[model samples]
Target chain A: MSRVGIRELAAELGMSISTVSRAMNARSDVSAATRERVTAAAERLGYRPNQSGRTLRRGATGTVALVIQTNTARTEMGETFYFNLCDGLQQTLATRSLDLVVLPVGASADRDRFLVNAVDRHLADAYIVSNTDRTDRRIEYLTQRAVPFVTLGRGGAADHAWLDLDFEGVAAHSVARLAGLGHERIALASDDRDINSTWEYACGYRRALAEHELPADGGWEIRVPDTPEGGTVLADRLLDMSPRPTAVVLAQETLAIGLYRRLREAGVEPGRDLAVVGFRKNPVCDYLVPSLTSFEVSLVDYGRRLGEIVIGLLTASPDDEPVHEVWEMTVVPGESDAHPPCEKAAG
Target chain B: MSRVGIRELAAELGMSISTVSRAMNARSDVSAATRERVTAAAERLGYRPNQSGRTLRRGATGTVALVIQTNTARTEMGETFYFNLCDGLQQTLATRSLDLVVLPVGASADRDRFLVNAVDRHLADAYIVSNTDRTDRRIEYLTQRAVPFVTLGRGGAADHAWLDLDFEGVAAHSVARLAGLGHERIALASDDRDINSTWEYACGYRRALAEHELPADGGWEIRVPDTPEGGTVLADRLLDMSPRPTAVVLAQETLAIGLYRRLREAGVEPGRDLAVVGFRKNPVCDYLVPSLTSFEVSLVDYGRRLGEIVIGLLTASPDDEPVHEVWEMTVVPGESDAHPPCEKAAG
Candidate 1:
């Protein structure tokens, strides 16, 4: 049997086309009896709402696009983290009958331009902007256009909803854990890019050092790309230090694998000669020779929170308070950072 | 200035709305002079075609969705593989001004229902379906609906474009290499699911064994989940074998990490006591103490080729041949599969 359209439904119910549309859309102006009648008739007739028509009338696409940046560097390790988050978001959004579309923006000169074009074209009803830098122009652009959005990372001077990981808290906890192990000299390997999380991580590291009454040397803070190669570079630099660090905390867990390799190559054994702590727990971490000591955050929960906040914002009144959440990261101890070094080292 | 829509543009050019739209959309029915005049006026007035209007007229959306299945199991190692492929697809599509949307289906009961709804709603102009099983109902469904799609894996009884990894070739190569190193008995640790690739892998393994005049024992073939835990389980099974296989081929590289840990715990050094070859070369593979020997496929290139095929199908005439591609994986030799065991010992 052929599918029935709204015109046929309206004709069958002896109601105006606009009235039938309003009733089917659950508009408050439609009478309750008329709404039920229209709904029942539409259901019986096998009438499916044309998405294009509904979108034209309501200006809502019933879809949220999570725009993630993808490049050679990010694709290697960032996939699991983001995919888990996407899965979480999908689960939460699915309940609301909202589809989640992941928009991957490549690392190219026109990346910003492409985002702007997508926003202008109304590709999605709302956006979840990720990989936000310290001064993200997308935030300003989206805000100025009055487009509904929620960022995965905080950006500058935009009154928008956001959900960020407590990077500072993670760094503080890592420092405290290592310090309690009788390690005085500790190094931090963090993202070199001007992303807001990197800044937060650095701030947390220094604050923790100050709280523990230890020296916060700039030389000990290594800014590196979030890659395995970056981890090797950090390890090499640590080895060349005047007295070498007794322990090092890595912001990116993916780096742990490379750091272990570089440390072994330099005749330093992780968890014995040198202790290491990674910021996030990954699948590879459990398989490491001395399983990596890393921080853990339920990515599914993170995505669920994002979904709730974005949905709340979308459905909230214009004057409603903007949603903001910061997820606290907990450390998962492993053999990689079991104890302090036997020999005290000065750097 | 306010946006200049089709109505205003048609009025300014003193032409029928349909004629203006036809001319702007480059229909052959419009005269060259009229088309040039319409285009010039549109450029002068900064007039842009509305996407919804265009979609309604053309019956196509300028977007493609890659529907990837997401769950705890797939997220562990599949993320990087899929993300790199996505990045490649995006790069290729960006050149043609076609947007790529990644629709992640959760591993819940509603997964198939969600896909069907998306298909019915025409959420995307075309879909790139991944993680196909031996008898994927989605393939048959899409084929019946005449939906333009490209499957990343093979499916049953469907005349459609597909791009699959050469799993059989990789399995054959792994068996031959290990056999050359004096390994009489070998094992294959592959995905336990009924995916077409798993079937192909089993076929290739048996074919290689028969060619080498060796026994093709079913006990030597292990079907496990594509996870680190699965690898550990396979390692345990190996330890209990009557005459343990000297070499094992892992279909999933992520499994190598757990296998190494389990092997080390059991005092069986991977490179010395047993040889291991992984199917894919991942970032973690390089960091393993005895680095894993695995097959490598440029995911970016794979994605680019998918884009080419899908785009070709989208633009092809009805009678055009369906595009199909199979990527050959190259073995990246590492320390893990350096040599076979010197003595064949009973467990």
Candidate 2:
């Protein structure tokens, strides 16, 4: 049987092609009864819309783009995470026959201009923004342009759809675990960036310290670049503290391995000398000498949820509320975290 | 100053628009002198062809796509490498006002369909293929379609452009170094995949062994999945050998950490009990207890070279020779590879 077009369907239903098109598009101008009638006839006649023609008419490209900016200053610690997430997103999008286009932006300053050009060219129907800062201007720009987007991290206004990692929960859990292990003087290593995740992690650390009745030492919280070199530098500073921290929490898991190496070189065993807790669990964590104590979040689920949220936003009516989700991670305990030597000896 | 259009440039040069377009496109129908004259006039007049209009006329998208299929069975070891390479390619393309699109194909079976759809829709002007097999069907498919492309690894015919790592050189160098250290029973850990790199690495290993007058042990050439789990399995197999190999060479660096862990658990110390050498030097290599002795390739340079090859292929005349380049990697020795205990005692 030949596939029926909108024109054929309209003729069969004794309606104009414009009316049928409007009904198919869910336009408000079409009456509910007429839309139901037109839809039923179209379905019965096996009417399939021409993809290219529909795209031209609706200005929808049937593609979603993820723009990533390469930070030349530091080695990216989240490569595996991003790759896994992209795979998950692609899998989810494939179900809807939507293509995922990843655009790598080389220069940080050219990101906005590149995105604007992509949008103006009708390259994609929606976008997935990542590496968000606390006060990201891209959020405002995209909002003003009325482009449908979902962010991997929190940054934009509450009205925008976003799926952020539960950094606060991770911090709170790490602090509480260390406190349980009789660690009073604990240090936190965080990324030296304006990203919202860093702020959230800091907030959780401070709040958990208060809850545990631990004094907040200003010098204990160190900001460093997320790299092995940064971890080595941090190791020196950590050892130089007046009352050295018995336990250290990393905001990023990538630094854990480096910290271990630096500490070992200085004759400090990771788990026995200073308990170490990482933010995320990676394959490398399993191979660390003492094994890194870290949290694990299902990246596949996170990405799939993001895909669903973005699809929801794109297909929703204007009056519908934007979706906001925060995913919590589970901590995977390893030998890297243990009671301080004094506590262990006393026990 | 305002940008000059092709029409205005044609009028100024007193040539028909079609003639000017053909000359600018470097069509065979246009004389060499006419083509040069047209290009010179276009440059002098500051004539910038409208991007969208030119794309429609030439059936080009002004974009290059790298389609990567996710390997579900193994933990992706080359994530950082690919990410870094993509960044470099994007940087190179940005100079020419060309966009790089990354299309992630989830399932292996879906790869061909995805590429077909992408090409049929005119999503990109060219492609960058990676993780090539010895008998890759994608090469045939793309060549038949007459689409411009470049591969990161060598395969298909000599008529295609490819920039491949010097796997054979690496293997030869590793074997020679081990032989010089008086180790006659050196094992080789290679990928089980039917890829060209694996074959090349095996070839290099055998040739080097023959040159060194070392007896070949069929059981020493172990093939395993390129993952940490695979490393653990290989470790067990290596230990089970009647006369365990003194040293081992890994095709992938990510497996080194896991092998170290397994060896340690069995009361074997890496660099002491068994010397190990890895293929690539990554950030993880530095964090391992004894560190890893591996080859280091400038990923940025590799990516830039791949970008140049693809750009060259895209712009070259049909009769021009296809570029084939092989990049040699430098060995960064760490504690991972050392003389066997017997050899050390003998010395």
Provide TM-scores for the models: 0.81, 0.79
- Candidate 1 residue B101 C-alpha distance from true site, Å: 0.4
Candidate 2: which stretches are off by over 4 Å?
A1-60, A72-78, A107-109, A340-347, B1-59, B72-78, B107-109, B156-158, B340-347
Residues B254-322, candidate 1: write the lDDT tens digits: 778778889889988888888898887886565676888888777776787677666665665655566
What lDDT does model 1 reach?
A: 0.77
Model 1 chain B TM at 0.81
Candidate 2's residue-wise lDDT over B1-347, tens digit each? 33355557778989865567557656566799999899999889876432322222123577888877665333254255666777667766665667788877764336667778888877788888877888888888888999888877887464677778888889889988888887888889988889888888888899999999988998999998887788888889888886778888887777786788798888788888788888878764556768788887766656655665566656655555666667777899888776554544212
lDDT of each: 0.77, 0.74
Predicted structure with the largest TM-score when compared to the true one: 1
DockQ of each: 0.39, 0.27
Which candidate wins on DockQ? Answer: 1
Give each candidate's fraction of reference contacts reproduced.
Answer: 0.67, 0.37
Candidate 1 chain B: minimum summed lDDT over ten consecutive residues — where? B50-59
